[model samples]
Target: MSSTPANPPTALHEVWLIRHGETQWSLSGQHTGSTDIALTDHGRAQARALAPRLATQSFDAVWSSPMARAIETCELAGLGGQRVIVQDLHEWDYGIYEGRTTPEIRASVPGWSVWDSPVPKGESLLQIQARAEAVVARLLAASGRVAIFSHAHFLRALAGCWMGGAAALGAHLYLDTASISLLGFDHESRAIRRWNS
Candidate 1:
């Protein structure tokens, strides 16, 4: 009798990253870090619309930042019941730059960018990268599909880290509010299957 292959190839794992719906600060182009903000009506609708798409897939785990906007989006997306709060998933601390837009900040310091410039008392790019790496490690250690609800900057950083790139690489990936992205393997190499959808 022929025997089955002993070492079967395992299925590719996926990490689905979801950015929280829009908030007033997000709309105003403000740096909203460590701020407890609620979503707008349109943002709520955006979150609700994600449910159908999410329902199409079976996630082995669901995670969300402790921030209200992220948590609310998880709830509206119909995955709140299964979500585990991850404080490290919170947005990068903007420090004194909090509530100020890049342009506004640039008014004083020409061409200031969170990705390129340092925010006084805020999280450094390296610091945020470390957090992203930690999350990526956790997800990689787990089996099957996973989902995460978080903010824009943090999600971008996570995507960069997933691809084995520095968090500064996030500056090249533009993510919209309430968007969906996928991180998976490409023939044994980590890859971004989809982005900012």
Candidate 2:
């Protein structure tokens, strides 16, 4: 009788990409893009708490946004040793909308979607989405689990890139600081597996 290889049950590796904990802007619903900002005291505590959780999993690679908030989270989570800085993973540059609430933007733009409307002086969604796809392609070529710490908007965009296309969909994925999310293979293909989870 011919035999088929048994299902591996799981990929040999898994990536646990965690969005950095909340910043002042996050708590207030402001668009925090490339701006360099520090974590609030509560944000620091959240990062600290992530330490134990991180210790439980061993990653082949640990990466963080060059941004202070993300790097700080990685360090506080006890993952500072092998951290690699990935510029492509930085948050979406909110440009003129930086630190502003959606309602405020709507007040001026009238039905403008961040996904559709271009933020003055910032990279467009296409640019951000392309960067994300590159990162995912790199990861897929690598041979082990990884840990990535990053910001909200970009991470959401990255999630979209991971799924295939249309980074605009990232606008829908809500992530919590210090929260863990997973991406892995399902049936010989890439699948979200879990999100903002």
Q: Tell me the tens digit of each residue's lDDT in model 1 across 1-197.
A: 11121221144378899999999999999999999999999899999999999999998899999999999999999999999999889999999999999888999999999997989999999999999989877776677788999988989998888786578889889889999999887665678889999
Cα lDDT for residue 195, candidate 1: 92
Runs in model 2 deviating more than 4 A are: 1-12
Q: In model 1, which range of ten residues has the least summed lDDT?
A: 1-10
Q: List the residue pairs that clash in candidate 2.
A: none
Report the number of clashing residue pairs per model: 0, 0
Looking at candidate 1, what is the lDDT of residue 27? 96
**lDDT of model 1 at residue 149?**
96
RMSD in angstroms, candidate 1? Answer: 5.4
Per-residue lDDT value at 5 in model 2? 15
Per-candidate local distance difference test: 0.88, 0.80
Error of 2 at 101 (Å): 1.4
Judge candidate 2 at residue 114 and give its lDDT. Answer: 77
TM-score against native, each model? 0.94, 0.90
Top-lDDT structure, candidate number: 1
Note each model's CA RMSD in angstroms.
Answer: 5.4, 4.6
